[model samples]
Target: MLCQDSAFRLYLDRCRRHKFGLTEAQLPDGTHNEQDARDWICAACSIESRAELDHNLEAWQTFRAIRNRFNRWRARGGA
Candidate 1:
């Protein structure tokens, strides 16, 4: 239920905004929704589902790496 977690969802949104340099409202295609973040997470973690992050060590590690990078990006004032 990681994707369902409010804080995590917010984190995803923030990360996306930072990476894309655009807010959800500013996106030309009208995408950048929660599902898009979920899909991005799944693809980055190499998992078919977000739930696998809870049980799959490799996916969890990959997710941690992504989070760490996001944290650094935030620390550096990205976006």
Candidate 2:
């Protein structure tokens, strides 16, 4: 179970309406921030069928881990 926040729900709807993917750039709605995007994608991912959710979860986790690691590195000293 994940946090069912308003932002998450909004993104879920966005995903349902459009083709949601791992967007590298800032989403037009300003979902570029890591946590914000995660909230959006996670919600989006969870809204699909169980099979789809299961498949997408791994990819989402990988993406999030990589992004978080990068974020940490930047916080430390990385460019």
Candidate 3:
């Protein structure tokens, strides 16, 4: 299930402060394309894009940790 609107709103707000603010790109309709959707949501939530990230970087390897940080921040009302 998707996140609730209230939770999403809070996450969106937090994203504005924390994420790269990437814009959503519209794809063809009915495409089971989850990446675009995921990117859209992450953009909305201000979460960093892991798509083009170079996981070779030491900091990049900490991707999950970054996600956890955002999740924790969301739980804490990251405003």
Output the worst ten-in-a-row residue range by lDDT, candidate 3.
24-33
RMSD of each: 4.6, 9.5, 9.3
Q: Runs in model 1 with CA error above 4 Å? A: 1-31
lDDT of 3 by residue, 2-74 (tens): 2233444445444544455544333222332355445554554445654434443543445445556557876
**Model 2, TM vs. native:** 0.31
Best by TM-score: 1
lDDT for model 2, please: 0.47
lDDT of 1 by residue, 1-79 (tens): 4455455555666666668798667643324456766888899899998889889999999999977776676577653
Q: For model 2, how does the per-residue alpha-carbon lDDT over 1-79 read when each residue is reduced to its tens digit?
A: 2223444334434443456553434344433354555554545445433345455767567546645654564566543
In model 1, residue pairs whose N, Cα or C atoms come closer than 3 Å (at least 3 residues apart or on different chains), thus clashing, are: none
Q: For this target, which candidate reaches the highest lDDT against the unseen true structure?
A: 1
TM-score of 3: 0.28
1 against 2, candidate with superior lDDT: 1
TM-score-wise, the better of 2 and 3 is: 2
CA-lDDT, candidates in order = 0.70, 0.47, 0.47
Clashes in model 2: which pairs?
none
Q: Order the numbered candidates by TM-score, best leading.
A: 1, 2, 3
Off by over 4 Å in 2: 1-55
